[model samples]
Target: MNISQPGLFGNQWCDAPWRLVQETITGIQSLKSDVDFMLWTGDTVPHVDSGHLSTDLNKELVRNITELMKSTFPTMPIYATFGNHDYHPKHVFPPYNNEIYNATYLIWKSWINDTSQDANFLKGGYYTVLTASGIRIVAMNSNMYYVKDTATVNLEDPADQFAWLDSVLTNASTNNEKVILTGHVPPGFTTPRAVRWMTEAFNKKFIEIVLRHSSVIVAMHFGHEHHDSYRLFYNQEGTAVVSLFLAPSVTPWRFQLADGEIEPPHNPGARLVKYDRQTGKQLDIQQYYADLNKANADKKLIWSLGYNATDLYGIQDITPKSMGNLLDKMTSATNKDFKAYVNWYNTNANTSDKFPCDDACFKKMTCGVRHLDEDSFSKCLTAVSGSVSLLTFSVYSVFYAMLFVAIYKLFN
Candidate 1:
């Protein structure tokens, strides 16, 4: 579950109602029979407004969420990564030497429960845990390389953790153990409108290290886009190296692009990933979502599988090459495959139905496609706007202006 702070009782921009939080916890608790453990990729705080949310409040939110997880699955082990919004001052995450790290350390140390890991988590908010199945789980503080705010980041050692990762993978490989990596920001093109958060330079070195040990590193999991998506990376020989799964968010935060009008709210969702116990390769991924609108109307929580990896993308084993091929089909295919891509992206159940892919929404999904060429991106821009506009000229103008700015940023 990609958990975030309950969007309530604060000066936050958009938050999930308290009732939704309760419903989400109850829904997960009911699935304990099917789930063995939880992969909680971060964003523990709500999207706050301008004012400084007190440290006490921030820690309280983390504590509350931690307690909720413990209550939901008393014996389940949860591996989590911190999201960009999980820090103080919104996107600004202070380094380990600061009070922020100390505060966060106190909250997470008890949950993480390893003295060695506590030391590492304090230094860089990253650590590695060896599961009983001999699988290595690397929890990374990927926000360290985030581009939005660099000052709060300890530039002196920004990419040091990647070096740490290399060492971890080397040891895991030597021990004949399979590895799973978890982080908040994925390596590349998380969304088309903006470049990936981990600077290309860092991502390059990170991928190089990953390819060097791809045999042991079986799968990667991440959550930040708040949408169901996947990313692929290839080695120098153009062979598939790694694949990352982007988990859907639990918060029903209203969807907006800065000053743009809010689109339809995303349904709250989570995933259950199954793996080949012996090989550590992913067997399948099952995504489940609750219709927030329907839940609100009926005052009853309902959850169901949105889809599985194999049925949606047509791949038995998740590899970077397989995901890349799927992306090609999504960008070029004209019939059911294309429609499926768009509908699954929108989280719409019916492909024939008029799904919401407004100018702002459509570009985001297109841009997120891995290795998307400029010409194809331009075609996507045109196709989205081809539909007749019901919005006024003023709104249309603003949309175009934003689109122009987005294109400018994409190129420059």
Candidate 2:
């Protein structure tokens, strides 16, 4: 999940002669995996003011990022969705125009349409990619549903998008392919009240549609809320239609808490998700962070929340059986405790001089961050494995020490 708020930096930030392309290349190379496909969850350029609708510089930035991505991941298929920032011209401008939209789309098209590389880009910011495992990955154009006012935009209740989604879900169901939905804005969070209201409404409609084809709609991945979150939206029949997973932003800006505190603050990272086609299960979901503590750390590079190294903090196995159970628990006590832990960290954890939140408090508290019950169980499993490894090392150390002592005594 590559959801970086690049546009938040503004024109100056985007124009600044930065080696972000190189840093990005390094970050992707560190992952060390042949990914099936890469999802770019929008917001690629700096957010431009409404008046600067025709900013050529912003266009160049978008073009640069797209080109850079192509060079970095030559063989991987790249898909993109627009964020509010990317769709500013459509929303902020008085007249609903498609000039900026067309330009931005053209930029993506240039890279995606290029057949020279092993990349396949989709049109309309929404399209389906049939993976080798027979799973259908749907990337939605979330910008169509956003209605931005001077204050904020509504995200949750996207009626038009919901209609489009309904059609997509219906088609996926008929085809009998497992579905993974990717977009910019997620379906939860009530802040930015208008967006929340829309999202809630959208969720209701989305849940209804998902319930109709519950088994087909497996996971919904998104990035907007710059924190890792998972919520399962179920239908009245107790069928789990969608499991919402929000990816943290790979940018410096962290979510502002109620007390004006930010926890696990201002790090850049991305998620590596592996799905099992046979069982429609998420085999592995890990978050990776760019290391910022090195002697010559690039100040421009940021780490995502929960990012430790060039990857996520933990190795979570969400295989079919585990994922089903995990989703159930995640929406219950498990998720609540996770949120509580974050609140505590924001209020109590000190991140002033640190890179990512790597204090003991964070390590001890991470297990409780989300989906408490499942994470707790996961933590127990991790502890047991850790203990076994430690014990094995200790036994060897003791045996070596005893042998050395015996040899010394014999020599004496």
Q: TM per model?
A: 0.79, 0.63
Model 2 CA lDDT for position 137: 67
Model 2, range 1-412, lDDT digits (tens) per residue?
1333333221111221234334644565556455666667766543335465445644555666667667776766666666655554534321233445456666565434434221112223455566555667677655554334322234343224455567767887787778877777555432211124123344445446656666777677776655445555545554334566666554434444456643354334466665654645665555554433321233455533343211221224443334335433323223543344243222222345332322233333333222112323244235642432111001110000000000001111
Taking the tens digit of each residue's C-alpha lDDT, what string does model 1 give over 179-259?
888888667665534445666566565667777888888788887776666666556565556777777777655456676
RMSD of each: 10.8, 15.0
Distance from true location, Cα of 137 in model 2, Å: 1.9
How accurate locally, in lDDT, is each candidate? 0.60, 0.45
Q: Say which candidate scores most in lDDT.
A: 1
Worst 10 residues of 2 by lDDT: 397-406
TM-score between model 2 and native: 0.63
- In angstroms, how far off is 299's CA in candidate 2? 7.3
The segments of candidate 1 whose C-alpha lies over 4 angstroms from its true place after superposition are: 1-13, 32-34, 50-52, 152-156, 259-264, 331-333, 349-368, 372-412
